[model samples]
Target: MCRWLAYTGTPVLLDTVLYKPVHSLIDQSLHSRMGVETTNGDGFGVGWYAPDNGTPAIVREIGPAWSNRNLREIADHVRSPLFFAHIRATTGTPVQQTNCHPFRHGRWMWMHNGGITDFHRIRRELALAVDPELFLDIEGSTDSEMMFYLALTFGLEQDPPGAVARMVGMVERTGHEHGVEFPLQMTVAVTNGQQTWAFRYSSEGASRSLYYSTEVEALRALHPDMAFLREVSDETRLIVSEPLGDLPGAWNEVPESSYGVVGRKGEDDLLPFTPQPV
Candidate 1:
């Protein structure tokens, strides 16, 4: 289990989201209210896309985020329109830097807050299913990273939602073959420097908590005096494992078994998500 957030909007210092909220990601690393664990201190990572770079910059460390001086400094210095921050609580993998969240490919970034049940039992099978070329790029042993590569193999670069659904379908099919009744759980986020997509789903129908920020225009109407809301663009939004603060009408729970897209053209969407057989 972990706590993560994705931001796509006007460029702002990472500190505005990671450490400024009442229940910020850094705060969640020690006092999370809605995660499986109260403290997610196994490791931490942040990835941000600069205005000119197609590939995002990621900083990961195998240590508690709450005490990480480097993360604090980076958060204060970096500004980007799109970014992802995650605090990890290991399920079964080693607490190593490579195993941290916000895993990267060529120009895409991904992070997950759930696990594939009995992953050790089906690891070899799933590994064998990945495209050989993409398989060579896997840098971590965690199921989260494996899912990223699987999605890439299944065509993430061409179709994000479809690729993820196919990835889930493959995991579910393989898990069933191995006798694991409920094999998947995830609250995932993916971005390629422009738009961002978030999904909440589980094989058992009870997914983990996930939320997206209310529309900036709507929030402005509700909290007229909030200076921060006044500063960001109407297209700005945040998708998170949990709400960042207690601001009334500021967060909306993502529907169960559904996915939302915060698009670059401001054509945001929330749609039903069903795992498709690969």
Candidate 2:
């Protein structure tokens, strides 16, 4: 239902991917090859963790990313080591600024690329499960934002994996209770400024498309002639909803029902995720 990418590595202007990539998020907004929809223009948002501050700055609006002049101007200048960019295509939610993805809370930033089936049927029940503190932070009416709060309610700050897993489990249960056969569908990304975690999964086992770049050093060794590879740092890595370019060895498909974390060169990690009761 949407397209997104997360970047973690050496700092660079946001345009490095927001515009420079051959099939960047902007391109995906209008010509997605693997997303459910070719155009994800309902709304858009971007969150970046600047160097001096611990908190990320988020700019969200209710316009299409492809033609938003403000997005273009900002991308040309903003630089960050960790950032999330998303293009939205509404499944069942109204198109509004608050409903945009790349939702932010405190120092954490989150965004999702899919939906919880029949969200309206279980919205209240699922919302009631969130911790009152976080529930009060809810500003939109999308399953995506609700999922974020549920993760917080389940203790995301203490244990992100368990909190997210429990959040998914709750969505599945809530959906089933509301008579949806396949309740949860989400490919989500969440970050705490210092670390980033991205997941690909769905209740039906067929998840939205997601990919992560191969190691820059490995890619450099594999295709030494490519100028872009020679220029970027060895630690630079990108996880996206589609390939950034047509480069053969530039990306690897993220396995369904799994998650990946991007940190320093030696700190990148991958792990399996499964639904578990809260």
Instruction: Say which candidate scores most in lDDT.
Output: 1
lDDT comparing candidate 1 with the true structure: 0.95
- As a whole number from 0 to 100, the lDDT of residue 118 in candidate 2 is 84
Score residue 119 of candidate 1 by CA lDDT.
99
TM per candidate = 0.99, 0.97
Q: Which 10 residues in a row give candidate 2 its minimum summed lDDT?
A: 260-269
Where does candidate 1 stray beyond 4 Å? none
> Model 1: per-residue lDDT, tens digit, 101-175?
999999999999999999999999999999999999998899999999999999999999999999999999999
